[model samples]
Target: MRLVSLLVVLLLSPLGRAAEQTYDVIVYGSTSGGVAAAVQASRMGKSTVLIEPGRHLGGLSSGGLGATDIGNKA
Candidate 1:
């Protein structure tokens, strides 16, 4: 859900300033998905740039909420 929202925002963002620079792919937010997108673009021989507004990456998981279901499932 979060990824979808991010994508929408990026898609709607203004392109005037962006038009000055050229890139095969521009991934907003440094979330895991963003990283993957940039990586995939690079693998395809395209110039890719990953932009992160925050000072860190990995989204909430890297923001100290990496806890998982380690308890018994039963």
Candidate 2:
């Protein structure tokens, strides 16, 4: 009985192992913040993946803004 059960379990088990992608961090979006985060993660020696909805990066800056110029601090 034990042998039969063991054999059944073994046979019922998945024959192929699922391939898993491991990453320390996953950044969704290639915007400035996303790029910065990914770069920081890479600098820290952690794996990172940056995904962008658009074809370009740098978000608004890449959209012909040239420079962000978020004002200056007093």
Candidate 3:
């Protein structure tokens, strides 16, 4: 079983990773939800790869848009 798991990781690692890069989860957007989800997944003990084509994190939070128009906040 250990060997099988190792083999699986070896085989899938390349396809799952970028050139010389590896990540269990590749998040393309830096949205609030995406960051939260990635954090949650990491807490679950899984390798994660977060990638945001955009040049910033926190979708709107880092974008200087605080005080959401919504009626609730987490």
By lDDT, the better pick of 1 and 2 is 2
Candidate 3, 1-74: lDDT as tens digits: 99999888988897766677667877778798999988988998889877898888888878866666557856
Query: On residues 17-57, what C-alpha lDDT tens digit does candidate 1 reach at each position?
Result: 36677898999998888888889999999999999999998
Ordered list by TM-score, greatest first: 1, 2, 3
Predicted structure with the largest lDDT when compared to the true one: 2
Which pairs clash in model 2? none
Worst lDDT run of 10 residues, candidate 1, spans 63-72
lDDT of 2 by residue, 31-72 (tens): 889899999999999998898888899888688776545575
Candidate 2: lDDT over CA atoms? Answer: 0.85
User: Which one wins by TM-score: 2 or 3?
Assistant: 2
Off by over 4 Å in 2: 1-19, 66-74
TM-score each candidate: 0.60, 0.58, 0.54
Count backbone clashes in candidate 2: 0
lDDT of the candidates, in the order given: 0.84, 0.85, 0.82
